[model samples]
Target: MQAPTRTARTAGVLFLLTFVSAITGAALYAPLLTDPDYIIGPGADTRILLGAVCELVLIITNIGTAVVLFPVLRHHSETAAVGYFAARIVECTFIAVGILSILAVVTLRQTAGPDAAEYLPVARALVAVHGWTFLLGPGFVVGIGNGLLLAFLMYRSHLVPRPMALLGLIGGPLMSMSGVAVLFGAYGQSSIPSALATLPEIIWEASLGIYLTVVGFRRPRDAETTGTGAQESRAPRS
Candidate 1:
């Protein structure tokens, strides 16, 4: 048993941050975005602001995962690491756009009376933008990046157990299928099937976060063989 290097510890924390911020952001925004009354009625300013702030933090953490892991991942596959980073960035960009769309609703609500004829349609459009952003961002982009590329890297590198990584690998395609289904009007994004499709990915991410935070990544063989750095304790075999 050995201690994880400073970089591994940092990456572990970043992974946890990514998980927490994403979940918290969704919870914070769900209420404001789902209720039509929130868009039409007054006194949602605070909620809207809070939602926006959470989204911003989500963006930060989303990027943090890739950025923090890049160094270690690059050692295994530089191309994949860069691709994963790019994918996360793309996901965050779409999410940021979605946040702006929802924020537009807040701005519109503040400016227009609930009963105003122009209010409902414009608000609906804004919400639609946000909805599409969600699909494109989390449903598609995340499946491609976080679920697939990240899992592939971790699997090859043995950063986490292969089974845990397999969950993500399997989940990614399912999520992508669901995203396509949503795109084609086969089902709603919030449908049970969609949730089920994403469940493996969710579990993989959460488990990965917990694993990294608790045990950190296995020391790369090069590092171990060279005796160039502090040897990290290996995560338990699953």
Candidate 2:
């Protein structure tokens, strides 16, 4: 078999970066963020520091996906490619804002001391900022950028299997809709329904990363034919 092309290798790295960042960031933030006492509790400093690190990774890799894929994707559709890249940038910006909010909470916790209760309101507000950023960045922004544009391009180009691409096609809109529902107070963000709504997208991303890493995309027809011809030429003849 032929070695993977530079484009394929780059795609693999980008996908893996997104996969790692998503999982690690969420893991670091979810439990602590969910706890009401997190801001006032012991180890709050360490937890917030970890959250900051994770968000930073997410911000960088989120934009990296668009940057790495643009060269190849643009060849297929320049308009869509640029749109995806821009959307990713927006997503990353919101994530960075969220990180700042988390840091603010940490700073307050450090200085408030015995008067932490007095500053609780401000901490909650900062947490709310992070929550809104999460909703907008991974929830809505991903729907437009990673979900719609990325999947559509892959589907159109036959870069990966159509069924795999369909996951993003279907999941993206659902996630975005769910995000809107949360914004409107349709359901709690941490509720079971919310989890179910987001599951497809989670699977879509995980599958995308694995597929790109292991399968490394489907080669164009002409390239496959050329590879086969070259192999046959190198075979021993009678």
Candidate 3:
């Protein structure tokens, strides 16, 4: 009913949308990601095109989450709040780059002649670029932005339950570390270890989204002491 409550719900919906778009995009991209010779074969351009659309949605929702939450989060810590917003921008940039790379692959497939050998290497190279972007953007930056920064803000402000915040606290570092491992060739990107590390951060975001959408932010009892002066001033003093 109130502006703040509306903002929380908007942010929650954005977060949930990010989840759906990201997963759908990734799943749709399987043909290119998993098949080395997909470019030479009868390409699934339609599927790839749909995947691109999903990722485009992901970019919008990703930034929306940060933008909607910035006002409330800044009340607790302006620096971190700004950092989260910036991180979201950076993540979206990576997502955009990845989208372009795959779309390029699709374009090449459409234009290539009967001699597909020449384009194979080029296609593979484009796929590689997308892979790196995926790792760096969602894999690395997400841990810092959503996992550590966002979680820390929620934890400090008690916007959500402490236990939910703890998931991010623990998951952020793990996800980042796993990304580094993948970057260094310690393990494959989709390895069990990487998935294990990513699990907590996923849970954290999902839980936060559901909680904010269903219940809205709970007014912190220690609002006066928590640096949320604006929120405290709005409350009636006994």
Q: In model 3, which regions exceed 4 Å deviation?
A: 1-3, 221-236
The true-versus-predicted C-alpha distance at residue 216 of model 2, in Å, is 1.3
Residue range 1-238, candidate 3, lDDT tens digits: 1238888899999999999999999999998888999878888999999999999999999999998999889988999999999999999999999999999999988888787778999999999999999999999999999999999998887777778898998998889999999999999988998999899999999998999999888665544455554566687878
Clashes of each: 0, 0, 0
Q: What is the TM-score of each candidate against the true structure?
A: 0.86, 0.85, 0.92
Q: Which lDDT value does model 3 have at 86?
A: 98
Q: Where does candidate 1 have its weakest 10-residue lDDT segment?
A: 224-233
When summed lDDT is taken over every stretch of 10 residues in candidate 3, the lowest stretch is 220-229
Per-residue lDDT tens digits for candidate 1, residues 19-90, read 676677777777667776665565467766787887788888788878788877888789999999999999
Q: Please list the Cα RMSD from the true structure of every candidate, rounded to 1 decimal place.
A: 5.6, 5.5, 3.5
Ranking by lDDT: 3, 1, 2
Cα RMSD (Å) between model 2 and the true structure? Answer: 5.5
User: Tens digit of lDDT per residue, candidate 2, span 96-192?
Assistant: 9988888887788788888888877788888899999989888788887888888888876667777777888998888899999999999988888
> How much lDDT does each candidate structure score?
0.80, 0.78, 0.90
- True-structure lDDT of candidate 2: 0.78
Q: Which stretches in model 2 have alpha-carbon errors above 4 Å?
A: 1-4, 30-32, 222-238
